[model samples]
Target: MRSEAASPILAFHEELASDIRTGLAGPGQKMIPSRYLYDDLGSALFDAISFLPEYGLTRADERILRTHARDIVGRLPGPITVAELGSGSGRKTRWILEAIARRGSTTYYPIDISRAALTRCALELGQLPSVRVEPIERDYLRGLSEVAARRGKSDRLLLLFLGSTIGNFEPAQARDFIREVGERLKPGDGFLLGTDLLKPVPTLLAAYDDPLGVTAAFNLNLLMHLNRDLDADFDPGSFAHEARWSAAERRIEMHLVVRRAHTVTIRGLDMRIRFEERETIWTESSYKVEREDTARLAKHGGFDCLSQWVDREWPFAESLLLRR
Candidate 1:
């Protein structure tokens, strides 16, 4: 089993060792962890892709948050502390913090894996008098362990799981993530969840695999991350980004395919890997959820959906739930 105590330094060391052995030695292929895709450059590229017309998930989810933030925040019914999981750019989170502050004084908590991103968001959010931005640099999977260590107030916790990050995982994984949130939250606490609703399969596919090929570049950026972080010779030009819709899974899948047969080396790991032409490395999968499915997941994890709202234009949802 993987040790939870593996700090980023240890993780980096393991990656370096693996890369040196496999990345530089010879041509072999393996899946790269999607977690590395958000280094500064990749995060900025993702922000750009979010603005593209083809990517409607971000905008649609933002609209739901903007339109219903007040209603959702109003449901809290008491002084609240807001916690956001997987907060990327921290754009939409600002709206929620403000909304909750207006209703009652608020203390904002933004949890992310990126320390730099957290600091940037913390500095920007500090301006609001009601917003006390505590940046927690840890994976959301750990939930409140580190967060609880930092926060002693023990106030009612409200979660902001926005931008359809919930879709990034499969059903079981999503349930587990929510259950972790439930475990950390008190009975009166709430979990505000965001999800992309089921839509036309073509629409879903196009969102990840766009016509202008921006999505392609976004998908292939994984190789750039691997090369930079793991000291591996991953030629970005050698991978053609591919996206496919999995009917059984009801999600859009993103992959980076080897452009041609090749070998690469990672010096630290002393490993070499081979790739057949067109062999693909899967990167991400975003699952679409219906209201019933979303509610079921939340309820089974020890919460009941209080209210759910959808965007007027596209099928996206923001659900507010209270611990059961």
Candidate 2:
């Protein structure tokens, strides 16, 4: 068991305790924070999810980056800082960094929660000529805030928040997050956002509930983490993974359904959690955004849509937002 006080990433264990205990033991529907789903194993599982044939998100975004890397880099002025939020693995970011290098040497800040991921990204990116990769080991907003404080007004920037990660936040949360980010960024700074657009229900569903079962493993890994950290007795095998589209909400929700009524105790939290047969613990929501919706969201976030790139086949987009 890792000590929460010792590990920066695991420091949120207390917060996880409160959320899971309250969410599982509270009234009505139960819920858990999707953020907790990214343990080392979960992160690896997600990487596998990216490669699954049914999952077109990674491929779609890569296509955009490959096709328009130069065009995207052209929008931002040189002697700039390229900061990426949640830059896990930094595979797609290689495209942008290559483009940035063509213009000139610039500072690269890759912010991510997993220090392991950040280290790997830095090592790979630092090898690029004239480019310095400094990674901030922190969450999204906090990392951006830190960058804003140190950077000067004259510093040009191109902030990248790719991977349709914004889709994870609820609409209101997304709006607030983007707005806060905009306040920290100066005018003329560019925000590149990759969003999974509203597509056919079947395609969206398949992406989350892939036939390869990678998504299922990813969903179940959350329980494994909870059991390990919280001293909870959770039989991950006893839970069934489920992914479905909430048409009204325009999002796909993933859940772990109880296979049988049972009680489990988290010794660390000193709580006994009970689940009725068929009860579900809602885990994640990926909200799909339309092009018009993305434009409106940028406006709410104090940005104007400068350009938008859509995948040729899939209804996925990479939109450039300029802070106004």
Candidate 3:
């Protein structure tokens, strides 16, 4: 984990100790933490999902950012530093970073929990003439304090939160996070935030459960990681991947279901576990936010909303928020 990602991510990791213990002692105990979903291979697979036709979130979002990046930079007043959360693969980030550098005076600070992703992106980004890469190896939540501390008196900041990753946080947590981030900026600073919006259950389901079955393979990758890293015996083939849309939360939840009664061993912890058929492990939640809810959260975060741009069909929305 990036040391800078924050205490909350560590808190979650510690919390997992309790969950992992509970999960092993009894049948149908607790769900696995979502953070474990990105074990190198999971990271690469998710990056591939960005290109899949069914997952239109990434492409549509990039379109808006690419179209209006100059406008966003212009509206920011001048000479801003660009800081991003979850700056994965540095694909869309290149646009905003380059835009800031085009002005001849700007810096890019990218914070991600993955050191490998950060190191690779930083190496590539360092090649730019006017760009200086301040790569942060920390979870976004824990690293927010350092982000606030790094701000200078004369700086205007542009915060990039693309990829709809914001959708992963629960509403209350999302509200708290946005508010905290807003408190760290100046009046002219802005957030170019991307979010996946409400959609048909089928459309949403397909995005998570692609025809290629790559998503399933992605979820099971976690089990493989645990076996390799934690010295656990998880028969990846014995479990099935499940993805479903939760209408109440308006999100997609991924689960891993044990297909048959089984026993497994954790060599690191010297523990044994038994699973029954149909036993499931919750892995991730991807929430789709309504416009009003998003705007209200932004307002509470001390931002005056400037604009919200959705796709041609309104499947997603990218909002431009100026700090108040």
Q: Pick the candidate with the highest TM-score.
A: 2
Question: lDDT ranking from best to worst?
Answer: 2, 3, 1
RMSD of each: 4.0, 2.4, 3.2
User: What lDDT does the true structure give each of the candidates?
Assistant: 0.77, 0.88, 0.79
Worst 10 residues of 1 by lDDT: 19-28
TM-scores, in order shown? 0.89, 0.94, 0.88
Per-residue lDDT of candidate 1, residues 129-150 (tens digit): 6788777666675545666555
At residue 219, candidate 1 shows an lDDT of 72
lDDT of 2 by residue, 6-93 (tens): 5655546667878887888889998998877877778778888999888999999999999999999888775678899988878898
Pairs in clash, predicted candidate 3: 2-137, 4-137, 4-138, 5-138, 5-139, 6-142
- Model 3 lDDT, full chain set: 0.79
Worst ten-residue run, lDDT, model 3?
Answer: 4-13
